[model samples]
Target: MTLEAIFGMASLLAIFSWIALFIFYPSKWIYQTLFSGVLIVLGIMYLFYLFTGIGSLADFNFDSLEQVRTVFSSDEALLAGWIHYLAFDLFVGMWISKDSWEKNISRWVLLPCLLFTFMMGPIGLMLYFIVRAIKTKKLNQSPFH
Candidate 1:
């Protein structure tokens, strides 16, 4: 099998593992570790493919639905990549929404995080961590943990 095919299968397996972790044990350390590790590894592999030109990471050439359909039908690896993209992206959105609601963070701030998460994945998560750190700093100044 080609490197692309192997990577594609790995991506799909990671997504399924994440879904299983969430379903079987909702909010636990193991779930977090598994999900984050899988996501990070898949993301790094995607970047490697993009930079090394082993495979196309984004659909930059397809301009029409017919073209997209043909590509997907002809390319199993591309289909797997699409599945990984959707799975991780939707999970990122859901994570931001759930965490924001639980923390009682303002909806205004959360809305941009949700949008960025959909568009930029880990960048959005990094921004959220920055915001959380700043908030925690300010709160701690007021005699809280």
Candidate 2:
């Protein structure tokens, strides 16, 4: 398959996995496994593309936006970057779902975080943390002591 096909498949899987986890199934270990597998596939595909081309991991620079843009000018480089986002963001989304469930946070609260994570990654992580913290604080407070 072409790089674009792989990219699209991975992207769709990542997005669908998170949304399905949030909506259809919660606390399913198999879903977590499936999502992690997709992440690993994307990472491996990106690494493979980097190896075949000129994306030197040992000397990659991120000192400036222009430099980053230059690096991602190549199709392989861009896909690699996209896969990086897919892997990390999906992992974070998975974590949020699992952790929130353990803490008994409502699914409604996690849905927004998961959606944001699928779209913007770190922002979703931050939002989930904020919500988690607030819920945790509420749980710790005395109701009528």
Candidate 3:
């Protein structure tokens, strides 16, 4: 296959793996392992692309982000990327929301989770953990403890 097609396939696979983890195994060790493995595979594929000089995956110069943005702005790539992003991030948000509910966390905290998924992908997961930690600390500090 052409390099661009290979890269696109690899990207799609990585995204699907992430979605599976989020939908089926969120917060579990198996999920973590699977997600990490997917990332490693993606990294290796990217390295292969870089070494082969077939096409640029990411360029480190000042215009790198703009370059990526431009590529993603195309109709086909944008549609595909948006599909991948929304499917995975929505699952992530749902997982976080479920975790919060399990911990008896207030629903208000979920707003940020939704925002994070829509805007920053995994950053929302990190924010969820941070909020969870804060809530846990408060619980521990309570007189009932």
Candidate 4:
């Protein structure tokens, strides 16, 4: 397969995995099996691209943001960056699902967090923290405590 095709396929797979997780709320199978499997594949692709495809970590000049942009100029390097986002975002989504379930927060609340996590990594995570804080505070204030 071409590099572009591989990138597209991997991206789609990660996206579908996120939707599956949301649709099947609290599903251990989705989080543990499907998501985990996709992450492992993405991780291997990341390493492969890093070592044999475009460039190496040595190419990145930590001293300057401009140098960092220069290093990711290659198609392979860009894909690697994208794959990095996919892996981490999916991992975060899984964590959000598991944590929300454990906290007894409804799936309705988690849906947006999962979607945001997929679309814009840190924003989704930040939203989840807000949700958790509110839920936790309410629990603490219950007169039945």
Write model 4 residue lDDT over 1-145, tens digit each, in one string.
Answer: 7779989998998988888888875776787676568889999988776555455567766578888787677777778888889999998888888888888999999999988999999999989888987988752332122
Best by TM-score: 4
lDDT: which is higher, 2 or 3? 2
lDDT of 3 at 87: 47
Q: Which residue pairs in candidate 3 have backbone atoms (N, alpha carbon, C) closer than 3 angstroms, thus clashing?
A: none
TM-score of each: 0.43, 0.80, 0.44, 0.87
Query: Candidate order by TM-score, highest to lowest?
Result: 4, 2, 3, 1
Cα miss at 14, model 2 (Å)?
A: 1.2
Error of 4 at 79 (Å): 0.3
| Native-referenced Cα lDDT, model 2 | 0.75
Model 2 scores a TM of 0.80
What lDDT score belongs to each candidate, Candidate 1 first?
Answer: 0.57, 0.75, 0.58, 0.82
Looking at candidate 2, the ten consecutive residues that score lowest on lDDT are 136-145
Instruction: Give the winner by lDDT.
Output: 4
